[model samples]
Target chain A: MNVLVYGAGQLAQMMYLAGAPLNLNVLAVDVANKTVVHPVEKTVLPQSLEQAINDADVLTVEFEHVPEELLLVAEESGKLSPNLQSILVGADRVREKHLLESLNIANCEHEIITDIAQLDGICERLGEKIIFKSSRDGYDGYGQWRSSTAADLPELKNIFTKLDLHKVPIVAEKMCPFTRELSLLGARNESGEIVVYPLAQNTHHEGQLHTSIAPAPLLSEALQAQALDIFTRLAEKLEYVGVLAVELFEHDGVLLVNELAPRVHNSGHWSMHGADTCQFENHLRAVCALPLGSTEHGPAAAMINIIGCNTFSKNFLSISGVHFHWYGKTVREKRKMGHINVTANSYADLADKFGNLSEYLPMEFFPKLLADADRIK
Target chain B: MNVLVYGAGQLAQMMYLAGAPLNLNVLAVDVANKTVVHPVEKTVLPQSLEQAINDADVLTVEFEHVPEELLLVAEESGKLSPNLQSILVGADRVREKHLLESLNIANCEHEIITDIAQLDGICERLGEKIIFKSSRDGYDGYGQWRSSTAADLPELKNIFTKLDLHKVPIVAEKMCPFTRELSLLGARNESGEIVVYPLAQNTHHEGQLHTSIAPAPLLSEALQAQALDIFTRLAEKLEYVGVLAVELFEHDGVLLVNELAPRVHNSGHWSMHGADTCQFENHLRAVCALPLGSTEHGPAAAMINIIGCNTFSKNFLSISGVHFHWYGKTVREKRKMGHINVTANSYADLADKFGNLSEYLPMEFFPKLLADADRIK
Candidate 1:
């Protein structure tokens, strides 16, 4: 079967790799250039995007922010998986929050602010400390504003006015005092068969994902059940197909929905080495309506992002279980160039290898690893 | 760095898949058309083979049978790994045998026969039971003949005459009574760092590899040492870089070298899932002069080739540890369409999963699995 993926980026490149062994032809559309690039070979050839999409048996997206016009064209073909609605919900923070609230799912207290005037009463109602995120086109902490205290609200209001918050609006959320961040990745097929990956503990740096560890060490059954429950409710409610990542905040023992990513996610990259089947492959399988593979986890696994740096020595492979995945992209500041996934027989072994990995990478890129090393030990 | 692979076949496709995550551009040249095909995308675009070769930082081959002219060009560029001589030795049975003997590696008693008359006294000289293989362009069970008894010699001689055996010549070997077939895959970098995967027990059907189990069940340390010793000697002698697979025959307690594959071999497919570093990635690493990854094996693993069939249900993935690799080839008689690799915490778990996989595959293609089920139990 052939699959056409919207957005020719690293995720698409990875999906292309995972699909090859499954006998699936994965083609990527360069949304920016209106051309197609071979995900693995990266060869820009003379082929019309329309012709490629017309030839594909299935259409999917690697990122939620795919152009709406392209998505409408794919939707007309009736091949797009997880549907346009699900992707739209993931793209717009306001819609996502509304969907969660409709299902009575536990989520951070928030209000949609379309006008600067609406921001006046938001802090009084929710809290003084809040994070304001663009309802659309926001990622990696971009298009976001934070109010540390009531004193900072007027300054934030002024900035919002300058940015014309009336058009795009902003999701003002009361910052929850969560102990740690976690993400749950789940795949649902057209047949409604759902499989969820183990919860992964995630750490972010400068608003970008820095590291993730699967089976989230010291996780309790109660917390896992809560996260999976939230994932299932959202997946079934949306009639979702393919992989969906729900970023959550673990506040005390309860889990609250933080955001949703309607695609294979970076936090689940460890599954490439740590699970029986990875999220990329599973996502493809789901989109193609193939039987989902097992989501069984290995003993212990961690993924460290190779952000904005491609100069790390390939000598990192000398460290056992360290599997490097360079995205074959030109390095840019704060961009995810690639990632490294490491698996071990035990948590202690994973920690030891991760510690060794920290030594190989620049300290600036591995703050999460440096901090987690001690906790893991 | 870019890698130009000489053959655009399944092995090259796999190499392409493995290299993408390493930030390496892996391009394949179609020797017949003198064009380049993206391995994952399979797009036959307009590009000159010479231009691709010129753009590549390193040049390698997916098989040993690359045309001599291309090898000469790559050798002239000083970018070929394993070098032209090593590949040439791998392609020619006579040269391979000579090299083995020069290294004093234990091998089946053999002689080079150029004429039918040379085969006259070979049966008497070597033994009654023997096998004849073409000196070049042989793979799987093709270009091979076997004699069961002394009475069969005249018919074999007649067949060889019809086949014009004198042109390519043949290597006649006394068949060794062996307990089982085993293979060792090892990689040597340009910097002289070598790492070897665990020995794998291989089973063949009608001379085509059917299945392979790694860390070869009940393996003795002495046998592993012997296999590694032979591999090191051959690799060092050839000054080989990249992965080399040595097929061996376990006769009584001794391991006899059966053949050498200068590139990745079918028996090492299990490494895709069973080893910390797969043969394809390590091969790329060695060729690119990057540090070789560890060769640590998972507890137990098995790989079954999906030969001449693509009709098997992908539902087999529901079985834990079952990983399918479809080569994206048009199915044809005796063609290796794809393979499945499975790993488990123990041999018994692997055996159980293998047994389950056999049920999902056609009986015609899985005789080895059926037989192994009982042995594993």
Candidate 2:
């Protein structure tokens, strides 16, 4: 069996590992070069984009930001997953909000701002503080604007005045005081058989995910079920296959959808070693119309992202229950270097063992910083 | 972190998976090639064999057949695990019998046949039914002679007369009836932490394993404890690091050691998905002087081997909860092609699922014809 993954990134590399043992040949398309190559085979081939797509049993994307024309071509060939509609909604915040509203799913209340007047109306209807976001090219805290007070709204709106509203619309949402952030990673097969992994509690720094703990320290069973329900409804509505990670905000025991990532997610990285079958392998199975895998969690798992560092100690090599994954990228600059997964018999034990991991991490960016910054507590 | 593995095969490939993530570089030196390479990086560079030994934090093997010279080098390096004494015993039937006899471990009572005329004397000291085996280069029912009747002894003697018995001595032992075959996959770290996975009931045909069932159905707790005790003693006695698989034979209420593999064994493959930390990952951790991983089992799992034959249906792809792993080897008659792992809520459920597996298998060489195989009861 052959599969054509639309993007050449870490996720595609991981998917290659999961696909290789099953004798599934995966060709990663470097869209920038329009050349197809096998990651493990390391073969550079002279195949046209159309020919590659036609040869694949299925076509999928690693990220949502693929060229729309290529996606249209894939859809025409009857191989694209989650469909163009789902990708469009995920790509555009306005369409995402509309879809959630149409499905009666509870999300952060927001307004679509196409003009300065629309921003004023949104502020009048909502509150003094809001988050203004560009409809496209935004991730990891980029392409965003913030209004902390009513006095700041006019200035923020003025900055967007020169842009075409239709081409670059702004979405303003109410800022909620949430208790915690959680994510649900689940997979829905073509037959609608959905399996949800244990909810994960994620901690972020500077809008970038630094760590995630599985089974979420101390979440209520009720809240976990509610989160699963939200993800299930979204997957069914989208007619989705493969893994879906739904990021949620917990405010006063109530869960609200923050965003949805319709592919293998960072929050699910622990599943690679902490679950019966990893999310990547299972996602491949789901997309290929194969059987779904068990979603049971391991004893306890914690995954730490190794970001912005090129070199690390070989000492970590001797750490117990530690598994390292390095993306074979040559250059590294705040690019997600790789990840470290640690599993233990108990959550506290795992935390205790990995608590001092950052200290051992080569501090290229902030040398001699206080030890507290390196601690996991 | 650096590690030296003795054999380079699929198990080494998997241990590579566990080590690659932690930046723990494992150098596997194939006895045949005398060449070492990183399985994940897939890079080949030359280093002094002794230098590779010196670089490792700890040393272990994928199998026990590593040449004695290499074992001595690692032992002299102070990193060889399971010790050279134990490995030598594992590699040669002569030392194995001597060690077993010294430890008072029960086995097929035998006499060393250094001369052809000794067969009659050996038969008299042992029993009427006897099995003869070469001291080295014997595995999977190869390089052995079986004598079930007196009529066979003359032919066996004549065959041995054609060769030099002094150069290649053989062990002749009494044959005993066994109720079933079983194995224990266990681990020991330098710190003396010991973990034993559930005993597996194995079925082999022509000496090659065909299937393995975890928690062997209807097994008594006493039997399980006996197996664990035997493994613990062997590990401690050898000062073993990394995983060890002890194959045994059950004759009535007593279990006797059949052979010992001082590394990851095929019977333990189910642990890749059935346990919290797979044997490959745990083996690396154990050898690297890291904490051992949990040996907890999943609900239930059964792994079936896919031996030689390239024409099997991909339909196993349709079975939910089934995982297929194919080794990338040039196809050959009776070679290990791949395996399929089936997991379910219960063993009965897994057996039921195995019923449909034949549909995806190459039926020509299937053990039973369809009519007889259909009768599961």
Candidate 3:
């Protein structure tokens, strides 16, 4: 079977790797250049995007931000998995919030603001502290504004005016004093068979993911149940037929939906080394309508993102349980070059290895990781 | 860094997959066509073989049977790892036998026969039971002839005469009465650091590898020590700087060297899912002169070759611990298409999963696997 991915990025590269072992041909479309590259075969034959899509048995996306025109074309072909509506919901915060509210999912209290006048009394009405995010085209802390206190309102208003909130509304959310960030990754096939991975505790640096620990050490059964319940409800409600990641916030032992990513996620990268079947492979399986693989976790595992650096010594492999995954991309500031996934017999052992691994990583990209590792014991 | 592989077969394809996460560009040379294909980027741009070799930081072989002319070119560039002489020794049975004798390695008693006349008294002098092997270009039971009794000498001599034994001498070996087959895989870097994987118990069918169980189920410390000692001696002797596989025969509790493969071997495929570092990745590391990763084995693992079949349902993945590796080759009778690697907490669990996995594979290609799985308990 052939699969056409919408975005030609690192995620597509990984999906290509995973598909090779299943006798599936995974081709990625360069959305901008309109070219197709077979990530495993490493070949860019002379084929148009329309021809490639027509040849593919199914169409999927590596990320949610694919151009709407391209998605509409794929939707017309009736081969796109997770559907166009789900992709739009993931792409636009306004649509996503509306869907969450309709489903009665407990999310952060928020209001949509299209004009500066709507922000006049928003601080008083909601709270002094709130985060404003662009309704569309934002990621990794970009296109976001925050009000630390009432005194910062003028600066927030200035930022809102600069962002041209009239063209794209902003989602003004009440900042919740949550305990920690967590994410749950799950897949549902066309047959409605769903499999959810263990909840992963995540840590972010400058709004970009830095570390993820699977099965979330010291997790309560109630939390696990709640995460799965949320995943099942959302997956059924959307009739999703591929991997979906739901980022959440933990407050007073209750989980609240933070956001949704409609694709294989970085936080789930630990599954490559720590689970029986990885998220990438499971995503392909769901898209192809194959039986889902097991989602059982290894004893313990952790993933550390290799951001903005690709010059580490291979000596890091000398550490017992450390596995490096370098995305073949040119290095640049703030770029996610790759990641490392480590598995161990116990959470303590994983933490110990993570600590040892941190010594080899660039301090600039891994400070949050080092702190997290030190707290493992 | 870039690596140029000698062959564009599945081994090279796998090496490409392993190298991608290391930020290394792995390109394979189609020996016959002299065309280069990048495995990960899947692009076949117009580049001469010399230019590809010049661009590569290191040169390695996917299979030891690479054309000698190509090896000479890579050798002249001073980029070939494990060196050209070692590859010749692996390719020619005569050279292999001489090396084993010089190193005092235990091997089957054998005599080199240049002509049919030299084979006249070979059977009588050695034993009624003997096996004849071509000194070059032979694998998977091809170029092999066996005599079970003295009466079969005339037919063997007739077949030998037809084979034109003058150009390439045949090594007449006495068939050792052995208990089982085993193999050891090890990697050596230019820095002289060597790490060996645990000896694996192997089973062959029709002279092709069928299944491998890592840590050899019920291994003795003495057997492991003996295997590692042999590997260390051979690696040091060859000044080897890449992965090597030593196929051995166990007879009366002692190990006898059967043959050696200068590249990754089928018996080591289990490491893909069962070892901390797979043989392919370690081979790339050694070739690139990087620190070798750990060779620690998972608790228990098994690998079953998927010969001449790609029709199995993906439902096989529904079985816990099963990981499929399809080679993306067109189906052909008796051809090695791909394999399945499974890992579990214990040998018994591995065995149980193996039994469950067999139900999904074709009986024609996996009869021996079914029988072996039945005996796992």
Candidate 4:
């Protein structure tokens, strides 16, 4: 079975690794160049984009931001999974928020702002603090402005006025002061079978995921059920055919939907070592229409990202259950060089591994390593 | 780092899959054509074997039977792990027997037959029941004959007389009555550190491996210690720097060496899903001079070989903890198509899974599947 993924990046590379054992030939398209390539080596294969698509048993995306033109070509082939509508919803925050509201899903109070003037009564209606984000991708996407206090509103409004919000709408959401950020990752097959991993508590540094603890320590039964219910509703509605990640915020024992990622998300990467079936394998299983693997409960696992640093010794692998994954990409500021997955029997054990791991890494880059380790208890 | 593996077979393909996550680029040398190729796809790469060897940081072999000329080229690179002597010993049963005798290791009582005349009193010295195997691999190799009683000695001698026994000597050993067959797989690093996985009980049918159960049920501490001691002695004596497997026959409470596989062996395939650190990864880590991964014991695992068959339904994967591994190879009579790994918390649980898996498999092809499952308890 040949699975062609739209993005030639880490997730696709990981899927390639996972798929090999199952006899699934996973190829990646460098959407930037529109050329089919080997997922891990990134070497150009002797096949045009169209030919690769024609050869693929299933078509999927590693990221939702794949160009609309290319997605159309894939969608027209009738092989793409999760379909175009689901991917677009993940790409456009406005559409995402609308879907959440229509489903009666609990999410932050928000509104689509096409003009800067709409900021007027926003504070009185929603809250004093609000974050504005571009609804689509590219430099225009993930673009953000925050009105944390009354004094900051003038500068935020001035920054927003330069953009034509009509062309690319912005979603203004009242920032919830949540206790912790968590995410539930699950896969839905063509047969409508769904398997969700335990929620993973996330910690971000400078807006990038820094650490994730799976089956997040101190998980309440209610929170677990709520997360699964939310995923079930959204996936069934979209007819999602691969792994979907729903980012959540926990505030006062209540869960709120924060974002949705249509494809494999970074927060689920820990499943590579944490779960019986990693998300990458489950995603391929779901997309390729194979029997879904079990996501059975296992030991506590922590995934710590190796961002923008590559000079450390890998001697830390001597520690039991530590897996080092380097992407083999060039070093650049804030680039995800690789990640280290540490599996332990208990939260305290995971914390100890982190403390041991912190000693080997360049401490400055992993500023939150020790902190997150201590938080596990 | 690039690892150039000799012999583009399933073993090399597995190594490629295991090496990718560690940022190791693994390529295979098609010794049959003296060309470099992708291990899994078997596609000819755009590089000469010489160039591949030049570019490789480490060189290893998937099968010890690789042509001596190719082994010479690989050994000349000064990067081969397990070294030339270790590989040679594995290829020649005569050398293997000598090494075993030199170390005072208990193996089958054997006699080296260089000429038919040597068999005159062989039956009297060893036993009436004897099995002879070619000392090397080739058309004229693995040539075997068995003499069960006094009446069969004349025919066996007549068959032996037709061979150029001097050029290709044969090892004639008295077949021993054994209760069980087990193998210990372990890795020795360049640092001389050794780690061994729990022994896997193996069952063979028609001279091909049919099934294996890891940490063989009802294992005694003494048996485990004996196997470990055997591995450590051989590895340290050879100064081995890769995974080595020792096949053993257990009689009463004693283990006698049966054979040595210089590279990863079929019995160890269970480690892929059963052990915390699989044998392939540990082999790559050893040859690459990386820290050896932990081989801490875990759940019992069973590996059932799919042989000469490709018509089974994969729905058996619906059973929890069942991992199906297909090698993507064209099936041939008696060829290993792939393997299925089933992990469970105990022997009884493993037996139950085997019962479920047997339903999805072609029972005719797996003659011992149900019987072995019953034996597990």
Top-scoring candidate (TM-score): 4
Can you write out model 4's per-residue Cα lDDT over A1-377, one digit (the tens) per residue? 89999999999999999999888999999999999999999999989999999999899999999999999999999999979999999999988988999899999988899988898888887788888888886964348778877677788777778888898888888998899999999999999999999999999999899999988999988989999999999999999999999999999988999999999989998888778788998999899887888887666998999999889998998899999888889999999989998889999999999999987889999999999988985
* Interface RMSD, model 2, angstroms: 3.9
Model 1 - which docking category? Answer: medium
Q: Tell me the TM-score of model 1.
A: 0.94
Alpha carbon lDDT at B153, candidate 1: 91
TM-score (second chain) of model 1: 0.96
DockQ of 4: 0.82
Q: Name the candidate, 3 or 4, with the larger DockQ value.
A: 4
Candidate 4 segments exceeding 4 Å error: A139-142, B139-142
lDDT of 3 by residue, A1-377 (tens): 89999988888988987888787888999888878976633456588999999899999998999988999999999999979998989999999999999889999999999888888888788898999888898433248778888888887787676666666789999998899999999999999999989999999988889999998888888999999999999999999999999999999999999999999999999998888789999999999998888888877888889889777676888787788888767889889988988988888888788778867877777878767876676
DockQ of each: 0.71, 0.33, 0.62, 0.82
TM-score of each: 0.94, 0.82, 0.95, 0.98
The DockQ score of candidate 1 comes to 0.71
Q: TM-score of A-chain in each prediction?
A: 0.96, 0.93, 0.96, 0.98
Residue B290's lDDT within candidate 1 is 85
Query: Once model 1 is optimally superposed onto the true structure by TM-score, how far is the C-alpha of residue A156 displaced, in angstroms?
Result: 3.2
Clashes of 4: 0
- Candidate 4, residue B125: CA error in Å? 1.4
State, as a TM-score between 0 and 1, how close model 3 is to the true structure.
0.95
Q: What's the ranking of the predictions by lDDT, best on top?
A: 4, 3, 1, 2
Where is the poorest 10-residue window by lDDT in model 1 chain A?
Answer: A138-147
